[model samples]
Target: MASKVGHPLRTLVAFFIVIAALYGLMAITKNWTPRLGLDLSGGTTITLTARNTTGKGGVSATSLEQARTIIQQRVDGLGVGESQVTTSGGNQIIVSAPNVQRDELIQQVGQTAELRFRAVYQQESTTPTSQPGNSATAGTGNAQGGSTPSAKASAGTGSASAGATASSTAKGNGRPGPALPTEPPAPPSPRPTAPGKGTPENKAVEWQPSQQDITDFASFTCPRDTQYYPDVSDQPLFTCNEAGTQKYLLGPTIIEGTHVTDANASIGQSGLGWQVNLSFDSTGSKQFEDATRALSQKQSPENAFAIVLDGTAVSVASVDQAIAGGSAMISGGGINQQSAQQLANVLKYGSLPLAFEISSVDTVSATLGGEQLQAGLIAGAVGLALVILFCFAYYRGLGVVVVASLTVAFATTYAMVVLLGASVGFALSLAGIAGAIVAIGITADSFVIYFARIRDEVGEGRGIRTAVETGWRRARQTILVADAVSLLSALILFILAIGSVKGFAFTLGLTTLIDIVVVFFFTKPLVTLLSRTKFYGNGHKFSGLDATHLGVTALPGGRRRAGTATRAATQTGGEA
Candidate 1:
């Protein structure tokens, strides 16, 4: 016989051997965990409609996109992992934060995120002109405007009143003047203060703002309109107000989070724990350099900028010098591996031009999700069992191949799903399970096609070896074409549909791809090898495609035998 391009026995053996090895590795890796979705995990999902509160709700794609960007920044500030942020209805934003504490998440998510950093002017507390690592000025002047984290005391007529003190202070060897005592009665204590009254010490510090804070041209009713700019490089230590209070006044952001191109958490250079590494685009790099240069000229606290996420400060570091490059590293105390990873995720995903506001908030109890999951599993089990039963009743000894192939398919699918969930934030929903159930039919059809093809070749008077080759030659094309159609449908659905339908489409697409792989690699090869066996090769009656049962007529003049089984050719000559 002339050799065929694809050997059936070789194909079958190679497929099963590879699948067996993959399944074994998956099992060894414990790739059996079922992933829980947001509903199952019991978290908060919020929807917000983006409307210009200042304007008369004039909605635009730009506004929607801006809102999404802001919302992502806000959500990231919350440090929630695998959170879903997307837009819908052109005006609404959807946020799904799974495994998050609902009420707290709601509170954090509900607020329109605002980023601000104000300069330090005068504080109500003790003012240090020069701290240990850095130094600054303690002028007797004041800016009678909004307090900033890094505001200098303006020298005015008040300088005359402190002339005597100034001379004495200047003569004291250019050292930082001591902070005035809280109480009086210590005559000539060198620390200048009004007699019998305590004066608030004033310190100069500039506020560095983030890009969000700067871009946000929001107006609010406040006693002071202090402008804030943040040191984009270094994290701030203690932002002080002009009133001598430890209040961080932020400036307009020179760089925004949008400038970041990529972010990831990894082991710190010191081998301590996790730290987030960030890289920004050209614009962000230039802005960062300028901001850092400005801060380098300021005091310690003012020389630092705070990375404010949501409403809380995640980090503060001092900018020793200007950072000319786009890359930066954030390192601090006890940033856990999980938190670092979350930060990286937020930064990485934040760059995508995706934003959403919650239009609805629903909390399905874990019990409900559990029930649904249980039902889905039971349904899958029932379907598998039914398929098994049908194979046994129809195929006899060949039923074992059907069962084994199905098991391998299941193992491969489950392992892939679990790993995808872990690696890509893929959550298996009800629709996904249904897709898997539907896959049962597809896998079964593959077996039926192969078996029927073998029988057709055998009925044509070909020996088992030739039948296996001819059958595969015919069956493989049909399987590929059928699967191609299914895969195309899945791709279309996944691309065009939304919500749960997309979930269905995704699973369908994934399974369709897997089906093609298994049939081509494992099933056909294994079946080809099996046809070489004595039981199968000798046309055992128990083999579902046995020629005797099928009433296969080898020749036109062949005599008919009574009580022989009969089967019709598949009408379409292809698998379902």
Candidate 2:
């Protein structure tokens, strides 16, 4: 079993097969290189400075890190690969992504994503929200911005409000009944806010709608301009439904998004199209319970609740009952698969401790990265040259094994880097390239250790095959020990480091593992097969394993080399 496992032909064949598979994938995908990091690719880099809205001390490390994680999710949700999001200088979050439009990236990660549960005091749109061809910013039909989570109420289809229709289907039969009747346009409720709104720190009180706020809602179109986007939760908001068919007047925020503990989007309990289920923390549960009970008692438009996100009403429905449990569901026929997913993602990944303002936006040119990349390659070439020179100097014939093994290792590592980039968005940074170059030295050490052991056994009067086998047994333990230390160091570095430094650690660890694979599957077996050839087996003077160079005076068969045989024959003749 051991012999079969280490057979030269078998090992070589398996090695080639793996290389073939990797090359096949590259051929099929037409991707020969790994995805380059933001540093290597020209793209937008947005630096956001987090501010404490409540006038507290600067943000804590924990809060900064939490914000970093959330922002990363938002970028990932946009499907941008090779994006780098990290905290800098404690209070700043830097986002770098490749090939993304400046405006789109800003909208995805720049918003405060302040989710508020506000009451709909007045909805004065003569326009129907269900109207087709809705192209508003918050409208359901806009391809750029689909129905966000708050676009519809969590309340079932029966409680769905105007312009947004939903049905409670019996099962997953793919059939939905007629659109539920939308409430007739009710007279705008008594003014819901005043011009003098309280700051967010002060518990927000529902305000009386000023003449201006009301007029805006009455004439406001769906997809309002950026100037009209929702602001502080203390003031009343005039915004349109995603469909642009309805306008709404929402009172002060009753609850904020931080209260949400978890959220998910899936088919409704009754198999209705889709729903976003929410689970709030203890504090959020009580606040929601109070808000729902109060709204349920109001009449007409006052009875409805609007789920506002980032100052826009994503969803609204009449509160039919008080919800005490921390968990709630948002289901409406308008909540199709795509909209449901968008809503759930926004809620689940939107948790952040502080608001961010983009302080500086810059472009990272790929040209600069390309220059850096060229330097990294030059450095790698120099390092590899040194390693190859040392191998040939120390082990003439055995140098072939070192070079071949390294070539295989290089091929395998390159293929994996490219494949991982394609499949998992693993970007190779400049630091990572440095790590790969360092790997050359690590790989060279293994061959030197193994070849020296072989020479030592041959010096002890062993045949070439015996020496090769015995040398491997002694050298493998040392090889494993050295690689283990290297791997351990790499793991620790990867764990402790952050940002681009992590790229270095990861590439180092990756290449170390590749080195071990090459040593076991290619290096050992190739050297063993090479020992069987006459030039090496007979210990030619320059074969590196030459008996003369290795200081071997006699072979196992009593054949003497390195002048020992000639000396012995001369002495015997003199005695005769």
Find the candidate with the highest lDDT and give its number. Answer: 2
TM-scores, all models, native as reference? 0.65, 0.71
Per-residue CA lDDT of model 1 for 1-576, tens digit only, reads: 224434655576576687677657657767668565565666677877766543254678887777666566656455443456787888787777665566555544454423222222112223334331111111112111111223222123221111112122222112342333334323211221112222111111333333232122121111122233222222321233222222333433345576778777778645865666777778766666666567656643445554444323344455545656666655443466755665565556553232224467877566787788788889889888988999988887788878877777887788777767655556677777888888888888987888888776656555566667789889988988888898999999887875566667878888888888887777776776666676865557786545554456431113331222112123323111
Q: What would you estimate as the lDDT of candidate 2?
A: 0.69
For every candidate, C-alpha RMSD to the true structure in Å: 12.4, 8.7
330-381: candidate 2 lDDT, tens digit per residue: 6552767766665676677875678788899998888887998998898788
Report lDDT (CA) for all predictions: 0.54, 0.69
lDDT of 2 at 161: 53
- Misplaced by over 4 Å in model 2 are 1-8, 23-30, 49-94, 99-101, 118-162, 165-216, 219-236, 242-245, 251-255, 263-278, 282-305, 316-346, 533-535, 538-543, 561-576
Candidate 1 Cα outliers beyond 4 Å, as residue runs: 1-31, 38-42, 47-94, 97-262, 297-302, 309-313, 347-362, 366-386, 549-551, 554-576
